[model samples]
Target: MLTSVYRLVRPRQFELVFNDITLDKSHVIVHPVRLSICNADQRYYQGLRAENILRKKLPMALIHEAVGRVAFDPTGQFEEGTLVVMIPNTPTEKDDIIAENYLRSSQFRASGFDGFMQEYVSMEPDRLVALPEDVNLSVAAFTEIVSVSYHTIQRFLRFSHSRRDVIGVWGDGNLGYITSLLLKAILPETKVCVFGVNEYKLHDFSFADDVYLISDIPEDFHMDHAFECVGGAASSKAINQIIDYINPEGTISIMGVSEDFAPINTRMILEKGLRLFGSSRSGREDFLGLIKLYNQNPDLINQLEKIVGAEIHVRSIQDITRAFEIDIHKIMGKTIMIWEN
Candidate 1:
């Protein structure tokens, strides 16, 4: 079957391309219903990445976060019309010791191969996870990113010292909000404190135990561990600040993406015996685990709805472009394109 694919030919330019999709017994056809804009997607759409990187990756369909309804299922694993969230991380081989997301051979969607910005996407059964039937889908569209936070927190449970009485999350963005909220729910005993520059954004973290402007954190305040969700130029600042306030033997999970390398205080890291690890994209297990977590706590979904931003219905390339433009100017929250393609 030939289906319409919207690919970014250049910066701020999208063109429709048609490609053949094999309808095989191993694949399930999915109709994308909603897509959430991510910072990584924005980096590509705005041409913020290096020219060489863009040249090698462009003329590519761009979106890794999307929810869809099953149009057809040959193997009967999923019934027709089942709502699901598509997992972007595609692992060619699995390892017992290494998780699928960390494997070097994994091929992620939108980054290189065609993503879900198509009229119909042919997905393997294992690549899709069913969503809650009555849940808010606009919030569900960004499940990929939320699972990322879950993945890191799960790792923290294994890696960090068990004295997680207080945890500090630096970054007032969506990732920080989700990470902190999950911590509050998953580790009910832990006090999740969020630190950020924007007062307005900090106010939105009502679920957090404490929200403080980075500069105003009381001198006596300290946390057992910290997470740096602030990516880009400020990542170093956030990481270093966490190190300064975090107790010894604490873990620092870094989830931010940066084009250029950010310097870290290696001396302080060694001095404090801190464990700093970087977390990138999530895998199938992470998505499955997160959905299970959501099922147990439906209220989490209700809280997630607060972060849903503009929902623009997109049918034409122009509407998609307008959505991206609107996403660029969004002060906070996730921008979703109600896919009508």
Candidate 2:
């Protein structure tokens, strides 16, 4: 069968390319139901990435955060019309010592390979996780992002000290909000404090124990653990502040993406005996874990509802462009695309 794929031929340009899809017993074909725009997607769409990187990565389809329905599954693992969340990180090879997401051979959608921006995606049975029938499809669209937070916090729990009293999350963006919410759900006893510059954006973090502007934080305040969700040029400052305010031997999880190298205060890190680690894309296990969390805590989905800023219906290539255009300017929440095409 021939499939229509929307590719980013260049910055601010999209071309619908046709390709033949071979249905095998091992593969499942999924039709995208809803899609969510990501900051990384925006960078590529706006040509904000480095010139060298763009030259190599352009003409690739964008969007990794999405939910789809099984149009055809020859393996019979998932029935046709089953709602599912698509896991974008496809691991070509696995290692015992390293996780699938960390493997160098993993092909992540919207990065080096084509993403879910096609009419139908032909993937392995393992690449899709079934979504609950009652689960909201719009919220499920961004399950990849929620899974990332779930994955990061899961790692943080294993690496951090047992003291679950106070945790600080820096950045008031959607990432910070989702991470804070997950921390609350995972560790209800722990106090999650969010720090950011935008008061307007920070106001949405009502689920957090406390929200404060980075400039207004009390000097005496400190946390046993910290998560730096602030990426980009400002990440350096966020990490520095985390180092200064985090208690000794604290574990810091960095989830931000920055094009240029962001400097950290290694001297302070050493003195404080801080353990810093980075988390990027997630894998199948993370998605399953997130689904379990959703099943356990029905309220979690209600909290996630606050992050839906704009919902754009995408039926044509022009609608996709308009969604990205609107997404670039939104300061808060996630811009979701209801895949009508």
Clashing pairs in 1: none
Give the per-residue lDDT digits (tens) of candidate 1, residues 17-36: 99999999999999999999
* Cα lDDT tens digits for candidate 2, 13-33: 999999899988899999998
TM-score of 2: 0.98
Which residue pairs in candidate 2 collide?
A: none
Candidate 1 global Cα RMSD: 0.8
TM-score of each: 0.99, 0.98
Model 1 misplacement above 4 A = none
What are the candidates' C-alpha RMSDs?
0.8, 0.9
> Which 10-residue window of candidate 1 scores lowest in summed lDDT?
131-140
